[model samples]
Target: MINDDLTHTPSTDQTTPAVATPDDRRPLGSTGLLASPVTVGTSGLGTPASADGSPAAGSTAFATAALRGPNLLVDTSNAYSDGRSETAIGDAIRQGGLPEGRGVVTKADQDPSTAVFDRDRVLRSFEESLERLGVERIPVFHLHDPYSVSFEDASAPGGAIEGMLALKEQGLVDAIGIAAGAISVMLPYVRTGVFDVLLTHNRFTLVDRSATGLLEEARSRGMGVFNAAPFGGGLLAGRRGRDGKPATYAYQAGSPELLAWVDRADELATRHGIPLAAAALAFSTRSELVDSTVVGMNRPERLEQVEALRTTLIPDDFWSDLEALGTPPSTITD
Candidate 1:
């Protein structure tokens, strides 16, 4: 369902012998960057310690391990944790050292205080990201969540889009991407034929296939497609919070009907004797439409957990049954 050059690993699906693994490195669209099927998201990366201005040792250790991988991609944003996400990740990479072919992808976000996504703000954002990330150049830089700025302003000459293109010209950014929600808003940007990547989150998961069209279009155009939040922010994995409460999708509550769908999927996984998270993960990795699946792994233990999930062999029938459940009614399906 993608370009001729974009190939996918064969799905295991009970009949296939190989279990789904993130070890396989594939080309990321035409960017010349080969990355792991799963990208480590730094949305949950903690801020630097106030006393010493250093990130937690755990985060650095995790980053070191991930960096050492053949070609894993690290996803971060300018606004995440008010810039500390980039700081922590950059610190980790600095301490661990960046390996060739391994990529770190960050986004240029609108000013949180001003809500300005104009050209000046966008350029400033990218500069800040570079400074925080402790890097001279970024492999991939995205315009993260441009909904605050109208389509006209974002696309106008010398606007946000131009700023990103300028970075590409200067060699500051190898590939420019558009990462946003709202299919309506994203589609128009997709037609511009300038972006080298597309990152969609919360909309392309086992429960919600809203980003299917976005993924398809990006793949067709030979642009890298990143499907984030495959676990719907831990709901599909049945993860609990530090408070021991059930995880919500995108940090909001889920509808009862949607919960029903999740319950059914969980039960089905139980019957199949496989982790529900595996099914959720496979939903992305098994698809040739997605070049990478971005998952938030705040701690080192997450590495082991993801490895286990990827190795779980799920049957095709389970996916069929889950699909039969259909999209749950009502929005905010957690």
Candidate 2:
């Protein structure tokens, strides 16, 4: 069952100071847009119960705090809770009186059930997102989950990519990007050189580096690389469900091997007196290839903790040990 309080609570506190200053903002490639090294992920801020169906009493508070910070980038989607995510963000921006420098990155090209990737559908989706976000323009708009549509269909005449380009031409969007779980599907779009950014999740975390090559390719092309889900879903965050098992990868149940990997990571974290989630966050953001690390937070406190983790100094030996435990060699620097 979905938690009632998580979906509709807008009265959460907003007194917390912004996490970072203007100097903390990082350039998002050559787009001339600057983003916080840590971007707030609002997928969970939408109305659906989180994977564990827990109440997210802190979502509004988190959003308000994040918007007030120096690096103001919130990643949301039209499909998230049927646009609740965008609405919530819009509401927060108004309530918090966030400045104009704050930027929003929303997505289009959802699956067929939610949206199609044709020119008309893409245009309609962007319009809806603009209304939901209460903004005349978006800094970054991505073609979300392109793996759901054939590459041929998406790149052909009257395709979604073409529609996005049109919006850029008209100044509706500052930059365009492709975000997806499947590297194979997103890489083709990156190679097109039409996109200014790329967002890859799950495949580039502490326990997984399958997207390392993809990151390298994006970097070589001077595309901004946004790394999402640095905690491997909720596993590296050390969140366990009522079932007593760790939250699975991408919200599904974990395989035995995956669970075992988490077990070892947890043990190592405990030995060092560090939160496993902190280690995971630090590991994901350490790479120079990553222009920004996006983490999903539904609570104000969790957002604060993440901000702390970004600048937290983990001992070098801890990183060496963590790397020894099986992070992909390709992703290791020094």
Candidate 3:
């Protein structure tokens, strides 16, 4: 069942992505890929639920928000609800008044076990994504999930990387990238200077900072970095449902350490006059490591929450408090 609190809460005010100052508008990472500061992650696009995995009251309303926003970089993958999400996004773009030519930045799934690298399969998927979105080409086409990407898998007769390179060669994808979960895997890609962008999650959120090193490296290398999952899977949102469950779905909140961290986060939020999740996004984006922070929203109301970061800045004191409290209760090591 959908959580009551999540479904009913009023949309809160949010911080908009910083307008690109001359310095801010520069290329993402070292790859020379320019983008807006706030990108829309389409995890919740066609889903019955939000990105945190909660059902939304209106799917049509949710999709419209994703397509009509400012300087949005919309992300999608074939694997999201078996293309329902992509189709919904396409519908939104076609129906909503988002600009064309420079419309959305989306991702393509390259699960080679499915023989995705086969030229026919690759073309089919790309075309399918286009058919779903009603776009000619994706501005940014990322090879979703790099940590699991193998050189063997990428170079094999029908591998993910090869398929992506093919798309790039065909001018279907304006830029090539990888969406990664691990710093270890992303580092090499950033260092190689091959791919143009990196979509990273969990590694650079409120609960963890391991992506700090990689973010720095990517910046130095001139590759764009998109930070995903800033709320640690909604734990920081401070939203809960009836029956005392969280407003979103996640692996069960861990042990005493996690619970204790939640307590500390509550204390911290009270001090900051904001919720822990807002603080999390503020912390994640304040870093030089991030070019854009991709947030999933199920409604325009949800965008209000994401927009709240416009004024949030982590003071030195906030960092000091976190250090004193010990490693945060949440972390994304993988």
Candidate 4:
């Protein structure tokens, strides 16, 4: 919910049919992962349905959009809002009458400090997520927080990775993936090629380019890559929008370099006559390294930010201008 737009509402009625094919059906990227170029993040879509607690307008807007065309990939986690996000997505799926074409991606969290791997923990976590989503099987299931755990343990005989693979084999999941805290954490798995997708941050994002190698690895292995946090937690989008504040409220005090980057981003937007969010979205999708850019929506109006994609696209020069204003890859000064 932190990065979501806040003016949307949720629906409680299940009578409405929420399935409609959009005119646009495109592959996510060269990676062969088919989906709408614009994927919806369900992080905060499940909050209170309405001010009266009937249904949230935000949820209805997303459901409507999903019904329109955008592959509608909803990402959630067992740990997000103590599992309310998933529960809310489930409620919205039922009440809004979402269709089967929309895919759900949910993560599994485990304590890294525990050297011992537990299959029961993995099963329980996935089962709870399925229950919250009110789905028989999640289209995509990921091994969340794949940090600190050894690859052997991660893919061991009875580890979480193995459990997920079992689920995939049993048809409980269409595909299995690894969502790490960083791209480096996903490298070993990428080499294994056992996973179909890799969801991680900081590799192709605003502040980092360290994961370029990982992207190539995934491509070589014929796996899909999703760039998370392309905005660098809103640092890349710069400040100010129709909302009148920075995209992220979580950052109260930022570095001097960060502020300067924000200023330059705004300048580039002004010069190119494009929105900062569009620039960021265009940047992420332009890269062969990224299959999809995950954008979170909490309000109905927030969808307007991305709705531009339906009609407008940023020019290549917008990216060139942004790169000129951002930190150099070789320089870690920021």
For candidate 2, the C-alpha RMSD (Å) to the true structure equals 5.0
List candidate 3 stretches off by more than 4 Å: 1-26, 30-33, 49-57, 100-102, 110-120, 146-149, 156-158, 184-188, 240-252, 313-316, 329-333
Q: Residues 225-306, candidate 4: write the lDDT tens digits.
A: 6766555555555543435443332233454555566667767787888766666666676677777666666543445556
Q: Rate the local accuracy (lDDT) of all candidates.
A: 0.74, 0.74, 0.62, 0.62
TM-score of each: 0.87, 0.86, 0.80, 0.79
Candidate 3 residue lDDT tens string, 1-334: 0011122321222332222222234356654456666666766455555576532335545556645555456666765656666766665566654554235676665544653444455566677788877878777877665444465566576666667788888887778877767666666656766677877776676666677887777667667788876665566566444386643323344456766677787797779676666677777667767888776665566656566664455566776776677776553445
Per-residue lDDT tens digits for candidate 1, residues 195-215, read 999988777778788778788
Arranged by lDDT with the best first, the candidates are 1, 2, 4, 3
The numbered model that scores best in TM-score is 1
Stretches > 4 Å off in candidate 2: 1-11, 14-23, 48-62, 111-115, 244-246, 327-334
RMSD of each predicted structure: 7.7, 5.0, 5.7, 4.6
- Worst lDDT 10-window in candidate 1: 1-10
Off by over 4 Å in 1: 1-22, 48-57, 69-71, 240-247, 330-334
| Shift of residue 168 alpha carbon in model 2, Å | 0.9
